[model samples]
Target: MSDAVKRLAIRDRIAVLDVLRGLAILLILLMNIPAMGNLESARIDVTGWTAADQMATWLQRVIFAGTQRGMLELLFGAGMLIMASRAMQPDGPVAVADAYYRRNLWLVVFGLAHALLFMWWGEILFPYGLAALLIFQFRTLAPRTLMGIGLVVLLASGHWFGTQQYNARQQLLHDAPAALAIKAEGNPLSDDQSATVKRWEDLQASTKGTGKETQEERTGRTTTLAAFFKWNAKFWMGFTSDLLVLIIFEASATMLIGAALFKWGIIQGKRSARFYLALMLCAYAVAIPMRVIDTQQYMTLALDPRPGWITYQISRLAMTLGHLALVNLAISTGVGRWLLKPFEAAGRLPLSVYFGQSIICLWILFPPYGFGLWGKFGMAGMTAIAVGVIAFQVIVANLWLRWFENGPFEWLWKSLAYAKLQPFRKTPSAIHITAPI
Candidate 1:
């Protein structure tokens, strides 16, 4: 086959992979909705929430927290290996290296559009693309090596994050009382004291957001397109930095594990049913309890770091793998395959589905540009609407895929990567998971 053909002609589809990707789409919404709708500072510190919001927050933390992003990172790793494989290249006009880099660069561009244009400051594609570029060199390593390095990075990053949290807690504990004392004495607070008070108040507000904070945020988001863009752009700066520092490291580690998993045949459904079952059970056994405890600590301990923060990386990795194993186990079972069938549409068009979700929620549902329903829903209500949106996307994705070869964004990505307009309508020969989502 020509290099160009190899760049675009991989047609084999892994049912288990599709189902797992589809599951990721479903899982991401459990968290993304509230992040888009609520006050930006209230992501974790829901201090004075109603019982339902608190329960919803804890339940989601236990079930979904890091696993959704984990799945996406790992899948991107799998996709990276698939694209970077030397088997896809030979002496020809098009090179796998060029295609791989081009595809990911365009992904970065798309991510920029998603964040800057569509107003989702927390989008993943930017970091995912950047991480892919950094790690592409490591794809050819042995699976064991990849996994070992990934685990090491994961541990180091987790420790660093935990240490930062611990230090912040210590600072707040020391400074908050001093700042309060100055205020009580009616003395002019020093500059540092004033800054300390601001930090302490922000922390407190994260738990129980003030009306002014929430209202100001809502007004900024819903006042006009310019205002909305400015709000998201400003947030994009800070959020994207955090992603680059900590989240990207975590994502890179997960993707490395993903590359290892793909090579080990675990992600490919080449393992036996018994193997998947044992893996699923073993992984969940290790992760679920830690995650539950972690959530409880974050909820109960004010301004204190979660007990599981240090080892939380292990729990997230284990839980994500457990979810992957469960999906594979389901694929091995006849009934399980049927249940996952609905998700194939989302899996098939991950780029479009992912972007479409932002357009629906950020563009239409919550912003002044659409329903103007920002901050109207709590965690539970936002998630409830997320359920409806997910269902709608699945149905629409299925319908679109029936007559089209690629989702619109997928087609654009491939065309740009290949530097040519590729075929788009459905045909016997079309692309599949030869590349990642």
Candidate 2:
């Protein structure tokens, strides 16, 4: 191929990635809307849901919940590898490695700001930043090696979590009598004992609740910015304390798989249509049944302590891969070409769309402000809102790309990563012409 042809091919490949990223971001918003409005609502018992709400929740669980974020993580890893390849071209290995770390350091800064200011405790960027730092060291390893390491770590972490939960439940059971005696006799229990009893009480209570908002939870969904910040601070502190390990592990594992897939050319849409179709078939064959069983167990068991939770991570991975295969198949076969364009545009500017979603959600949901609709929207309402936001973003992204080379935040992030002012605007004659296949 000629140089121009190669460049066009690269661009087209990137556009495909952008479409995937855009789709993933939209799905993430769909998954997060309920939590953004009322954290408890995301976990609302099935009995509490209206038919529409139940349908929406079921759709989200089956289609997007454990899958979308994984796609994003995979893209991040692929992007990292792409950057590493380019950086190595001219600057040598050490300089490229330095650049990689600096980029991730900046991402960490962005993640912190997003989590603290936006009050989104479920932020992935911070965890992605941390995982990037760790995974960078393994860049020289073979793709299969990286994938193997990731799988082992993911499985181990899942098992560890299950073991911890089971042990905690057992401990609580053992300490319940002592706690009762202390309460009845008006005797003070040790702090550790008190904590155990409290955990057990909370776990038991969680099984019976209709997902009603607690006083503290309701207080957090405030109208005033100051109140929101206060609640966010508390939420951040709690989340950072114990859950950080799981977050890091999950992010790292997904990224590792992404790195492997990218190396294998699957992520870049270089795979044959037949390969993708077969992958989709096999992956769903395993994932759908596994997910159904898992969902059924959760509904019936009500979060009962069980070792089976460890296998859930595997099921989620299967579903994630299945989704990836289906997307690649659609794109490769040109079946989704027309529908993919807007998503590709949005994908090209993912950072902007990501923060924009948060800003939009905050305005619409927070009280006495934009809509004062927080805690009022059921699952169906929230899903509708998410779709509306995505549609708006797609339109905005297409319009913005007409004049700008990058999204607002994308330009800023790239500038920060390079420690220089990068070009932001597209030249007058710089329109992207798609290469003919």
Candidate 3:
């Protein structure tokens, strides 16, 4: 590699951005535990719950639900910009495209392994990697253009997906009565009718699961790795279509906005306190209430499983941007650096911390071989565990950063991405660290 490429490789890591990413990871843990611990209860299944469970579920849906994922999407876009902004042509040992594409391809590999091996289908690495490949070129776009195009894409996606879902439910609503009537009259249902009825039933299963289905899932997941792998693979195939939608449009839209923000220098804590304060207030004012209404709609959705007119994407963008503004405001105002300091270290190792979460929950905490805690807790209990896991990661991340330049998984990823041996210690070195994941 040339001296320029080498120097670019070791540019000093940004602190405030790392802090923001670290905080996003911690909040993601809070939002993710319900799904990580019990797949059945990841939706609206509140079976065998307590008052605490109800309250926890309410709190998560109202405030912390989609925002965490949104924040990560924003950060991912910014990080991709920093990486992809370098030399575009194959100039040296590490061309920008080679390193960047290689890095994200490894992320795809990691994501697939995380889901199939760790049994966490909700993992974002795979999709984030996919979105990264598509959005990296937007790094050079003007901030306003990126934001404008992103907003259009986001709203359009919400409208299209929501309408499609609504139409499917409408079809089922039309077909069900006719199908039942025909069956009752001793005639078989048509193919479209049968498909509509099945879709209707799947919608029911999505919101609330029967105890029998939950038990069967838990048994399949916890019995053995080979069995769980086969089951997980099959299950993933069932939802690959929705996953593709999320990858191609929804995540890409949010990421575009993130790149715009980064282009404007807002994500680097360069914005004024007043500016961020106003942003946070306005975003939250719009989003929190929207989420409350969305929650109520979901509650009723169990009975009416059709997708209705909703602000799913709008609320998510508002809330996620609200969090971005809030964090930058706190940093710019210097009001909470003490609390945010440890997160700096935590953020630097986002790759390790993120994948580590799956290892902790899926590999050790929830599996039958470890604690066998899968499907044992409701939302409240699972959330409590998530909190503990977050604490553990934060403490360990700080300590790990003291002696090492990167977490273990980070070391591996960097090595593979750059196609070179990356320095891994905190000692004085000729190289700098890669940006946060």
Candidate 4:
């Protein structure tokens, strides 16, 4: 189809999708809390010696291990399609494309600021913004064509990521003891002292796991933009490369599927309940056990990093696919309805909640500012904090949405995109927020 001649498909109002987004938001926070603590410390903590730590570690293994990012990517893709369907008209493909791209470009700006200034270099928005540019070109594609492209992307990314993980495992095994040995030979006081306290104060930004700083020198008050870019360029490239492949693939596939489902009348009440039930059963039966076994084995492998690279990749890929299927089914079924209320409310204000969690965690763990609980908190403690955070966010989100048309960040993003203020406070008559069905 000629791009200009092609039409944009409109969307059915699906509250469940927002709930799904909410779930993604919450799960991401759960996955991130541990990592957030690590970012504060600037060093990796691998010891799960205690019972609670072990259980929390295992839970993280089973839930997030690889699936959290994958699921979030899927959700983002789905969200793109949904947003496009809403903002675009059948005969107005160009308008839709423009608006969508503009939204993403702004996100890139947000991500860059978040990464450099906020010191959360682990942010995914930049890559996603980049990928969205590519995906936007596919707006005019047939549903099937989009799905095919998504599958190809997913397969390519999975293979690429698996290979990288394999290499990383080998390097870590080789480097761990050597690095430890270097520490032992250093000056007694310097070798024994942890640089974490110093690193956090210097950066004021929590980065990836705790810091040892012997290998990499701390960038002090004199950190130049050029130097920051040099460090960030490598950091982002390495960071995104690991997950980008998976992100692109799962994201594309789930998005295409979502688009297809919406097109096929399934999302708009076009499909039979019976068909959805069958899909749910098939997805659950296959996905749950596959995830369970893969996670258990993954943990086993993490503890004993001697396995062949090829074997680990195969296991991870298999489980990743299962996780995708499970998530799809969850969304497809009416089950997502139960989760949608708070989630949609939360997602409507995603930025406020997303960055809010980071700020909250920073207060809890950053030394000299708050509790200084970085390496001290066990896995259970982290999970407990995450749960508490999630509960608090839900309450906050609901209350915020009752009076506001969009969450705080969502309003800001919209205003930025539109080049002026969009609606924020809900009018009495417009109090009912409706997703277009």
Q: Which candidate is the best by lDDT?
A: 1
Report the error of model 2 at residue 103, Å.
1.7
Candidate 4, residue 74: the lDDT equals 52
Using TM-score as the measure, the top candidate is 1
- Residue 177's lDDT in candidate 4: 57
- Candidate 3, residue 412: Cα displacement in angstroms equals 0.2
Better of 1 and 2 by lDDT: 1
Off by over 4 Å in 4: 1-13, 39-48, 86-93, 167-254, 265-273, 301-340, 363-367, 435-437
Q: In model 3, which residue pairs have backbone atoms overlapping below 3 Å?
A: 10-432
**How displaced is residue 156 in candidate 1, in Å?**
0.6
lDDT of 2 by residue, 122-162 (tens): 77788889988988766666889979988998878977886
Alpha-carbon lDDT, every model = 0.79, 0.74, 0.75, 0.57
lDDT of 4 by residue, 158-221 (tens): 5666567667656555555554555568833343233432332333222332244312323421
Instruction: Tell me each candidate's TM-score.
Output: 0.92, 0.88, 0.90, 0.72
Sort every candidate by TM-score, greatest first.
Answer: 1, 3, 2, 4
* Count of clashes, each model: 1, 0, 1, 13
Clashes of 3: 1
lDDT, model 2, position 164: 82
Give candidate 2's TM-score: 0.88
Query: What is candidate 1's lDDT per residue for 1-437, written digit by digit as tens?
Result: 34533543435666567768877976698778887776775535342367777888888888788888899888888887776665323432346667777788998999899899888888888888888887777877889999999999988989888877777778888888988998889999988889888888777766666635555566678689888887788778977776576877888888998999999988868899999999999999999999988888877746765658678888988998898888888877778877878898788789888888899888888888799878778777777898899999889988987778878988898888778886679776553433321
**Candidate closer to the true structure by lDDT (higher is better), 1 or 3:** 1
